[model samples]
Target chain A: MIHPSAKIGKNVVLGQSVVIEENAEIGDDAEIGHHVIIKKDTKIGNRVKVGDLSVLGKTTSKNKKMARKPGAALTPLVIEDDVRIGCNTVLYRNLLLKQGAFVGDLSSIREKVTVGEDSIIGRNVIVETNTVIGSRVTVQTGCYVTADMIIEDDVFLGPCVSTSNDKYMGEGNYPYQGPIIKKGAKVGNNATLLPGITIGEKAIIGAGATVTKDVEAGKTAVGNPARVIK
Target chain B: MIHPSAKIGKNVVLGQSVVIEENAEIGDDAEIGHHVIIKKDTKIGNRVKVGDLSVLGKTTSKNKKMARKPGAALTPLVIEDDVRIGCNTVLYRNLLLKQGAFVGDLSSIREKVTVGEDSIIGRNVIVETNTVIGSRVTVQTGCYVTADMIIEDDVFLGPCVSTSNDKYMGEGNYPYQGPIIKKGAKVGNNATLLPGITIGEKAIIGAGATVTKDVEAGKTAVGNPARVIK
Candidate 1:
């Protein structure tokens, strides 16, 4: 059932059993495939395409305790014009995707995250809450982005790159801090980053490296406890 | 559509557009989410909760020769009572989950596997074929379990733990033999286990450690090419 409060624009096509919740707005020339769920207060701009079984604007609070934190209302999601969301992706509440952004299949983007214009999130990528991804960034498949991350413009993260937040593994009081990938930097596949480290501009991290510290600008880091080289 | 020959018990809650194939049986008080697919001859027990978009009873055969070995009919999946299966998890055929087992969100359990009673398989975990997990095993999120593993009781694997059965990485004639994790052992997050190694009883593998050899019983192993530290 399409709710009465939903505002669907002209030339929009919705496939079989798609659910558009109350107060959701879809702009002109949008295509929503089968079994997609557009939750309440979501706004989709013109010429957007959402693939099959993708869910938009679901509420995410990390855990039950955080969800029950006082004064937490459901946040709104915004997707600008010319965006493409692939199959089975889940974008949580407070997500903002600028124009020309692309999100691939089976990805999960958490709450309060923004994908700047023309960014690309590949298949099976998981971006947690409060992460800011800047324009023209590319995060490849199977990469895990922890919460509170900052990926600046034109950065490239290879497939299966895993980042962590807590070094102590809940044993002690360790503040959660995600990695910082600066502009034009590139991280190779299967590289692991420890908490709170900074990858400087144009830095390169080799495959299978375990980065335990910050990588300086214009340098290359490789091997375990990654050191600067080349 | 639920198949006519399928047996659904009392007080079962099925969401919109769930598909239950022929001869599938769902026990009492089970909650099946939207777009979930339960294939033929699969048996689910009482009070089970299957989250949205999860697919049950598909078949997987990783070995090319075994998959080409003909005369294999569709295998069956058996889930005992009071189990909780999270969102988007996929369980292949020839699988068995004991009573009170909990499977977290987005996990993929391949064929011919048995998870013991009261065990917890965390989110995004991939347990390949022919794996046997003992009771009360805790495998945390994003861990990758290779084919043909034996995990004993009371074993705790932290998040992002990776295990492999083929050390040559599909290059040499490395015979497939997965790691043997003994009883009461603990493996910290991001630890990589090489092929065929035995982690002894009560052994502790530290976080980010790479296990390249057998770990002695009750010892603590840490670092790449993991050596006994304590």
Candidate 2:
């Protein structure tokens, strides 16, 4: 059901059973797959390709026990030109995807997040709320980007990397703050980054390492409670 | 689009845009959500609840680089009574889910897999092909259960646990063999289980541990290349 107030641009292709809510705007040459849902007031730019069953501009579901509280009203989600969204992906409201951003299958991007241009979020990745990922970043399959995190430009995160934002695991004493991965930092597969740490510029974290502290610039860290290797 | 050959039992609730292919069977009191696709010859038992955008009895997608090859024709998927499947989940063909099993949202279960009674597969979990998850097992959120694995009854895997089946990734030289987690074993959050290891009964793997070898029965393992603790 396309709402009468929704604006569809020239050459837009909508598949079967697509729901475009009120005031949603789809730019020229946009391709929306079957069963896609675009919520109210979402703005999708030209040449965006949304795969089947993708849900865009969805509202957040929060419980009372959560430390962070959302505001009364959130801004609409914005998608720039040449963005590619895979099947069964869920992108929440108040998010921004710059040009050429790619979200893979079964991924979830929460609200208040911004993904810069040419960024790649691989399959089954979970990017939590209030995170900022810079351009040319590559987050591989099954990685978890925690809430309130900052990933700078040219960062590479391998598959199954787990980032934590809470040190106390819901005790609510410590404030939630995920790691700050600086430019050109590379985290290997199955690595764990503890809360509130900083991965310095061009640093490398080895596979299966558990990082508990800040890593120095241009250094390599490996093992549990990761230590710098010469 | 319900096919003419599909068999729907009494009091089954189907949502909008649901697609049931030929020879598919839905038992009594089953609740199928919107945009759910049940492929040909799939069988869903009584009181099953399938959430929106789910795909059941899907075929496997294999490239030439994959080590294992699927058979010419696979059998239908079977879900027993009272099973619950969450939104955006995908279950491949030739699989079986016993009574009262729960598959959380955005999960993916590959073909030739068997999940025993009352097993809980949490959100964004991936169970690869040829895996056998026994009765009452609990695999927590964002876990990766590798192919050819054997997880026995009552095993508890915490959040973000990663398992591997290949010694050399994508080499195709080594035989794929994932970890064999024995009955009632408990693996903590962010743990990494290396290929072909055996986790003995009631063993405990500490959080953020990288397990390299077999863990003894009723023991506790911690740290990278995890050693037995007192």
How large a fraction of the reference contact set does each model reproduce? 0.03, 0.20
- CAPRI quality band, candidate 1: incorrect
**In terms of lDDT, which candidate is strongest?**
2
Candidate 2 lDDT, B53-141, residue by residue in tens: 89999988878877676687989999999888877889999999999888877889998899988888877899999899999888867
**Chain B TM-scores of the candidates:** 0.95, 0.98
Model 1 reaches what TM-score against the true structure? 0.84
CAPRI quality band, candidate 2: incorrect
In model 1, the fraction of reference contacts reproduced equals 0.03
The pairs that clash in candidate 1 are none
* Model 2 chain A lDDT-worst window of ten: A59-68
